[model samples]
Target: MPLINSDTNNVNNRGAFILFEGCDKAGKSTQAKKLFEYLKNNGHSVELWKFPDRKTTIGQIINEYLANDKDLDDKAIHLLFSVNRWECRKDMKNLLLSGTTLIVDRYAYSGVSYSVAKGLDLDWCCSSDRGLLSPDIIFFMDLTAEAAEKRGGFGEERYEKKSLQEKRIVESSLKLIENCNQLPLKEDLWKTT
Candidate 1:
C-alpha cells in the first residue's frame, strides 16, 4: 500500500526558468553567474546552464564545426544546434519539476535570432524551437555592434567577424523588439533595469 496523506503529497512550488539572451559581448555570462550565486546563497536550489553547452559530445562537434569554418549546409548546422537543445530538454524538465531554478545563459532564442539574422526566415527560425520549455523570463542584453567591436581581439571565434556579427545583431534586435512589443506586457526587449 502507499502512504496516503494529502498534506504530505501536495506538490511544492516548482522552479522558475530564467533565460538571458543578447548579442556577443553583452556581459551575459558575468551577470548570470552573479544572479545564480545570489539565488543559491538565499537557499534556492539553482542550476546554471549555458547553451551551446560546449562540453557535451554534440557540443564538441558543434564547436569544431564553428571554429574551423568546416562547411555544412545552413539547415544542417541549424538543425544540429536545435537537436543539441532537444538532447537537454529532458534534463531541463526534470530540474524544473524537482523545484530547482534553472538559469540559462542562452536558450532557443539565440538559435533563432542568430540563424535568422543570417537571413533565414524569422518564422522558420522560430519554428525550429517551438514546443521547447518556454522561459518564465528572458533577459535580453543589448549593446551596439560598434561598442562590441571596440572591445578588441574580435577574431577569437568564427562568429566574431565584426561585419557578420553586426548583421546578426541588427536582425536579432528587430525580431526581439517586434515580438516583445506584441506581448501583453510590452516591456523593452532588453535590459529591464
Candidate 2:
C-alpha cells in the first residue's frame, strides 16, 4: 500500500467521492463493486462510475485503441480519454451535489499515467484533466508484477505485460503522483489503505 492521506471533509452536504485507482488486475473493480453493494444495501445514496466509460461514443474510440483495433497518436489518445471523463462531469457533479456518494472505479490518475507511459508530456497529460473532479478518498491498490501476472487475464490489455516497458509504467506512475503533489488540491487526497 502507498502512503495514506487523511480523509477530506465533505462540505455543503455533498456526498463522499470514494475512488479506487491502481494498475491492471489490482482488484480495483472487485473492491469498488463490493463497496458499492455494501453502501447500497446499507441504504446509502450511491452510484459507481468507471473511466474510459466504454459505453459512450468517445469511450468507444478509447476502447478501440485499448483493444488494439485501431492506432492513434499518443496525444490524440490522451485527449480522447480526457474527453471521456469530461463528458461525465456534469452528471457526476449533479449526483454529488444531490448527496449521492459516488464510488468511482478509476479516474484521471490512471489515464494520466497511461499517457505518460506512452511518452506524452506529464503537464500536457494532466492539463486536459485539470480540475475535473477530486475524490474525497482514493484507494490506491498496489500489487507486485509477479502477483498481478498470477491473476487471470493479466496479459489481455496492452499495458499488462511486464517484459514490454513495464518500467515506463512504473516511472509514469511515480511522475503522476509527483505532479499531482505540485497542484494545491486537497491536502488529504490519500486515505486509509
Candidate 3:
C-alpha cells in the first residue's frame, strides 16, 4: 500500500510524491510517464515532471550544455542544475499540497551523483540542494552501464556516454541512496522489470 500522511488537512495527505532516478536509457522518464498515466487513469490527481525541464530559461541553458553546444565548468553546471530545481521547488510543493501526486523523473540525487562522480565534494553537492522537498517514494531504476549503452538513445546526450565516469556515477548514486535514512530498505531500492 502507498504510504499516507495522517494529517488529512495537509495537502500531502491527498497523494504521494514519487521520484524516479537512474542513468540515461535506464527508463526513468518512461517509467515516470507510465506511472503518471496509471494514477491519472485511476482517478488520482498526478503530474509528470522532468529535471533540466528544458522549457524554462535555466533549463534551456542546461539543454544546450547537455547537447554539447555550450561548455560549462563542472561546478557551474552542477549548481545550474540545482538552481533549475529551485526554480520549480515552490510549484512542486504547491502541487503536492494541492493533493496532487508528482511523478518526477530525476531530482537532487542525479545532481549529487553525477557531480560526485566528477570528483566534486559530496557534501557540497548535497548541501546545494538543501531545503528541496524530499520525495515520499523514490524508485531507482538500476541498469548496468553496459546494458544502458546498448539502448537506442545511448550516447546521444553528453551524460549518456558509457564511460568509466558513468560507472562511477552509478556507484555514487547507489551509495548515496543507501545512506539516505528517509529512503526505503536497500533490498527495495532497485526496481527491475
Candidate 4:
C-alpha cells in the first residue's frame, strides 16, 4: 500500500478516508498501523478497519473460505467479500461523518482485482460495491511478487500465490473509481515493481 491520502468534494466536514490497497504482504498492515498511531499520538480522532473483519457473521463465512475450511464458487466468494464491506458501510460512514479518520487496509479494490484475476468479470465485481464510501486517498503498496513470496508466512492465505498476486496490482482495481472525477487517479497504469 502507498500510505497516501484522498479527498472528494462530496464528502464535507468528514475525516479523511485513508486507504491502503495492495496484495498480501505488501506491508499494508504495517503502514496502516503507523498512520493510525501517528494520528492518535497527535490527538487526532482515528480508527482502523480491516476487511474480511472475521468477527462479523459474513466475515466469518469469508474467513472459512480464505482459510480453505470451506469452498465457494468464485462469484459466491466475491459477493461475500463485497457484502462484508457493505455490512460495515453504515459504521464507516458514521465515523467519517463524525470526523473520525478511517485507516482501511484492503477494500473493494482487493475484492474486484482478486476475483477478476481468478476469472470474474470486472463490471460484475465492481457493481456490488458501487455505492460504498470512496477512500479519500488510495495508497497502492508496491512490492514484487518475488519479494512478497519471500515474506514470512507468504503461502498461508488462499490468494497469496505469486502468479495471482502479480496480476493483482492496484491499477487494474483503480477502475473501481474511474467514474469518480475527484479522485486523482494516475494516468500511468503500467507500474512495474
Better structure of 3 and 4 per TM-score: 3
- Per-residue lDDT for 1-193 in model 3, tens only? 4344443534345556698987778888889999989989999988999998899999999999999999999999999999999899878877776688889999888888888888888887787787777776779888888898888977778888777446655568888777874322222111233
- Stretches of candidate 4 exceeding 4 Å from the true structure: 1-12, 174-193
lDDT of 4 by residue, 123-182 (tens): 777788877777767887878889999999898879988888877764454454454432
The CA lDDT at 193 in model 3 is 31
- State the lDDT of candidate 1 residue by residue for 5-114, as single tens digits: 22223335567788888887878888899999999999999989998878888888788887865767777777778888878988987777667899999777777767
lDDT against the true structure, per candidate, is: 0.73, 0.77, 0.78, 0.79
In model 3, what lDDT does residue 26 have? 82
lDDT minimum window of 10 residues, candidate 1? 182-191
Please give the distance, in angstroms, between residue 169's alpha carbon in candidate 2 and its true position after superposition: 5.2
Clash-forming residue pairs, model 3: none
Model 4 pairs whose backbones collide: 1-141, 2-139, 2-140, 2-141, 5-137, 6-136, 6-137
Local accuracy of candidate 2 as per-residue lDDT tens digits, 26-56: 8999999999999999999999899879999
RMSD in angstroms between candidate 3 and the native structure over all alpha carbons: 5.8
Comparing candidate 1 with candidate 3, which one achieves the higher lDDT? 3
What TM-score does each of the candidates earn? 0.82, 0.84, 0.86, 0.84
* Total backbone collisions, model 4: 7
Model 3 TM-score, 2 decimals: 0.86
